[model samples]
Target: MLYDLIILGGGAAGIFAAINAKLTHPTANVLLLEKNAVLLTKVRISGGGRCNVTHACFEPKQLIKNYPRGEKELLGPFHVFGPADTIKWFESKGVLFKTEADGRIFPQTDQSETIIQALLQEAHGLAVLIKLTEHIEILENHASYFTLRTKKEIYQTTNLLLATGSSRQGYQWAEQLGHTIQKPVPSLFTFNVPASSLKHLSGVSIHPVRLQILGTKLFQEGPILITHFGFSGPAILKLSAWGSKYLHEQNYQTRLMINWVALSKEETFVKLQEAKTHFPHKTLLQKNLFDLPKNLWKTFLEILGISYKKRLIEISLQQLKNLAQKLTGDRYQVEGKTTHKQEFVTCGGVTLKEVDFKTMQSKICPRLFFAGEILDIDGITGGFNFQNAWTTGYIAGKSSL
Candidate 1:
């Protein structure tokens, strides 16, 4: 069967594209192909199953900044269909999304299934054909139509949208079509600090802590989690995102400096001195001057070789200075990295320059479109990445006709 529009992925971008394409060209037949049996696997597990649909940021210019790779390219698409459009689109589909304090938007039910069901229902209602476990073995683009061959079937489409995000097969298909692909690498990962003092303090969370990748200007401040493997949290994830390319070049081995107390050295020392003077009889560990978790404070004290039972008054000037220094800048070697939960993202994909953002169509191939992580565009954690999916998918789907 010859389809008017064939989306080569069933992820967020593919599904969104298929729906929009069907809507824009009501008589056009849209088919969505997925290598996996399931559709929207990432959406099912996103945001801890809450499914971050889009970021709360509505401004188009500001929304483009979250993307590290395709910031400039996305600026054009985002202006056309940004976060506000995403919210409206989903809401119109009967899925009410709410934004969190951190600006991540999710359904009011707090279940990823809501978003998945909405997408599935919308696609089904629009008569968008969905075929699962259908892998494209070969793609042949002719002057009039593109032929996609699988083991058992030959499908042809006039408009082909490659929304296959980060899949190796997707890259292979783009390469076959004369598109340059960037080497894919891990992004939004957590550093594995084996000998970190916080290693034993698993389940302890600290907020407003600053993390800096040693030897680089990469820095982020937010909540941090001390896991058994190492550190995982918003701050570390953000740093991992910005430093993904550089750190990948470094072989995942780098030094990380942590500021348990997000305060200047002078300010930290003043607070410590005040604690010593005001609570002379209280033990340094018992006083908890930094508003840090009790276990974390004890771990730092142990690292500093200070007795937790020792009274603050008994601490000498040298020990006080050491504590302050450690609090402001504790360094650890990140020996490796771990996937930051199920929300793993790749930093590289199809080179962005080949695709026209205004229409999301390929410059090399007419009637060929691109969207989602398949492009070299990827955003940081939160809902920025999904917003990329919506913006590009909408443009590709609408303009493909």
Candidate 2:
């Protein structure tokens, strides 16, 4: 039987779109296909399984800032169905959400299953047919309807939605249907500094650190975690995301400048001078000034060639200035990148200009819709990526009907 709507992929956007499409037209025949055995895998593992459903940022203008690629394109969509709408939609389905201090919204139970169950239940209630482990091999548009041929069977639908994240097959199908595919690149990854002196402090986390790509205007400020592999944390992830394309162009070989104290060299110098005067008799190692972790400070001292046994008062003016510069403008060479845990986000997909954000319908092909990371839209860590899924899915589903 020819379906009214067929959503490719059982991810967040595809499943959500299937439910919304059924909700839009109660008797419409909708089918969702997934190559994987389970649906919503990403949702199940998001935010360390708590499932960051959406961010707390409510305003459309402010919410778009989180996305490095779809900032301007998402403005209209977010205004239509933003974080507030996501909260209400899930809450109405019996899932309670709580916003953390970092503005990430998660289920009160802190289990991603809560979210998966809600989406599954809604789809089941709406009679949305779901086929798992089914991969479509060919897609042919017949003007009025689309034909999708799987290895085992063939199906047809009047409207097809491609919510296939960053899959290569998804790009192929989109290209077959006449959409321009942007070259996908890794985003939201950690920098790999194999030769870093701070490698020993694997678990050391510093807050309010400023990270910058040495020769570029790209920079981010937040907490950074020193990993055995390299640097991974909010600031590094943000920087990686914003500079994904550039870093990819550079082959991930670039210089990363960091301000550990998030302060100017001059400010750090003054603070150092104050510490010297206040603790004149104490050894530089004894005071542990500047609020940096004791072990990290010691390592810094070692790297700077300053003796820990040296009294603060005995240090010369040049030595103080050197310490200040090191504290505020440390540089490290980034040799590669590591995926941020299980969350691998990409920086490219279908060109944004080719998709209508209002309806998420493809400008090149009628009745063809796109959503999620499959589009050239990605946001930094938080609920922003999922929010994009929900917003675009809702629009596509509603418009498909």
Candidate 3:
């Protein structure tokens, strides 16, 4: 059967495109194809199962800033259907969304299944045909219709929307269709410091710490979480997203300068001196002057070779200087990168310059469109990535019809 539009992939962007396409043009025959038996796998696993739907940033101007790669390309798309539109779209479909303090938006039910079911129900209501486990191995774009050949069958469509995300198959399709793939790389990952001093402090979190990639201007300041492997959290993920290309070129080996105190060198020194003066008899481990975690403070003292039992008054001037310097700026070597749970995002895809953001249609292929991670658009951690999916999906679907 010839379909009016065929959407590749059953992920967030594909599903959204199917629903919206059927919504705007109910008479059009739409088919969604996916290799996986289950649809919305990433959405189901996102936000640790809560499904971070989108961010709370309603303004398109501010929302675009979170994306390092497609900031300029997504401006027009976000202006048309930003986070607010995503919230309203889901809510109108009976799924209520709530925003957290960090600006991540999730279903009030806090279950990814809610989102999955809503999209599925909408697609069903719109009569969007879905075929699972149908991996298209070859796509032939004809002058009038596109031919999609899977292992088992061949389907034809007049219009096609490729939302295959970062899958190699998707990149191959884009390349075959005369588009350039930007060499996919991992984004929003955590730094892997195998021999990090803070490895022992797994599960410890430091707030408002400044992190700078040594030798580069890339930096981020936020809460940093110490894991068994190394560091993860807002700051590390932000830095990872912003420096993904640089780190990729360096073979994922780099050094980081962390400011645990988040203060100037002079301020850190003065603060340490003031603490020593006010609590002369107190041991170095007795108080966490920098408000750092108790265990982390103890670890720092031990690393400085300062005896935990050493009274503040007993600390020599040289030791004080060492403590202040370490507190303000400590260097750690990052040996590798690790994927963050449920937050894995790709840093590259089909070059954005080849697509028209106004309708998410490809300039190279008139009847073809792109959306989601399939484009060279990725955002930092939180709900920004999903928002990109919704924005592009909506436009691609609406305009494809």
Candidate 4:
């Protein structure tokens, strides 16, 4: 088969790119090839099926900061087609989106199928051919056109796009074509702490807690969860992305200091003094009184080995200091690491240095474009990953001619 464009992998980036490409030039023939029976599998599973379409942050610079690793490389991409453009495009398609208080953008209809249907419908209207279950095995880059060898047949196109997110086979394709693949690593995960105080306190969550992998400066906060495995949520996931190397270097056994309460040393110590002064005899586990979760209160008290039974009046000055220390800078051993599969993402692919963000085109291979998680850029949770799909797909579609 011969065409103007051939898009591999019919997920978020590939299909979206196909849709945009045909929209720009309705006469252009675009073929989207997928190895799966369905399209947008990742989009369907994302945000627990609601599909966080994009982040609420419309500013490109502010939006780029959310990505712990490819921020600098992502800046150019965002500045070109960022969050605002994504919202406009979706709204234009009759899918209105609303922002959660946390800044995640979801269709007011609250179904990923709605978003997928939008893409499918748009592509159908634009006459983009979606070839399912076709496995692309090789790419022959001639000076003029690109030939794609699939297990089933030979396909050729003037322009080609690879958006085969996270599949190692796709990485192999990029490497064979002169793209650098950063060693793949897990981007979102939960720390596995042993049977410590934080364990079994699983359901307890702090609204905003500091999570720092000891020996590294990486840290972030916001709704930290005490899971049966260890800890998770935005704070832990962001830190894991930033310090993935350091944590793995320590064999995931690094000590972590958590401030269950988002308080400074001064305020936290004063609060501890107030607790000691007023509820001198209350159990240390007494929670839901002032701070976030009460279970976290007990967990912190237990993690520090400070007996809550000690009478307030019986507590010595140094003991009060110790209590403050435990609450402010509690430390636990991270015995291991496990990707929070529920919100997991792959980091590192098709190194950004080799591709031009302005066009999502390979600097080494002309007429070949790239998009989606197959690139080294993966965003933090909060719809940034999907936004990358939108922006890169939009740009590639525009530049594909």
Q: Pick the candidate with the highest TM-score.
A: 2
lDDT of each: 0.89, 0.92, 0.91, 0.82
Error of 3 at 148 (Å): 0.9
User: What TM-score does model 2 achieve against the real structure?
Assistant: 0.98
Give one digit per residue, the lDDT tens place, for model 2 in 141-189.
9979999998999999999999999899999999999988889999999
Top model number, lDDT: 2
Encode model 3's per-residue lDDT on 79-147: one tens digit a residue: 889888888888888998888999899999999999999999999988999999998878999998899
Candidate 4, residue 319: CA error in Å? 2.0
Worst 10 residues of 2 by lDDT: 338-347
Question: What's the TM-score of each model vs. the native?
Answer: 0.96, 0.98, 0.97, 0.93
Residue-pair clash count for candidate 4: 2
Ranking by TM-score: 2, 3, 1, 4
lDDT of 1: 0.89
lDDT of 1 by residue, 166-268 (tens): 8999998889988999999989998898887677788889999999998889999999999998999888988988899999999999999999899998899
Model 4 regions more than 4 Å off: 274-290, 302-311, 340-343
**Model 1 spans with C-alpha error above 4 angstroms:** 340-342
Candidate 2, superposed: residue stretches over 4 Å from native: none
Q: Which model is ahead, 1 or 3, in terms of TM-score?
A: 3
Choose 3 or 4, whichever is better by lDDT: 3
List model 4 lDDT by residue over 1-401, tens digit each. 56999989888999889988988889988898999898898888888899999998988889988887678987888888899988998889999888899999999988999999998999998889888999887888888898888878998899989999988888998888888898777777788887566677777777777777677777777778888888877788888877776766677778888877777767876776787778877655562234656656655555556665655666676766776676668888888889646457888888888898889899988888998889988778889999989888999988887
RMSD of each: 1.5, 1.1, 1.3, 2.2
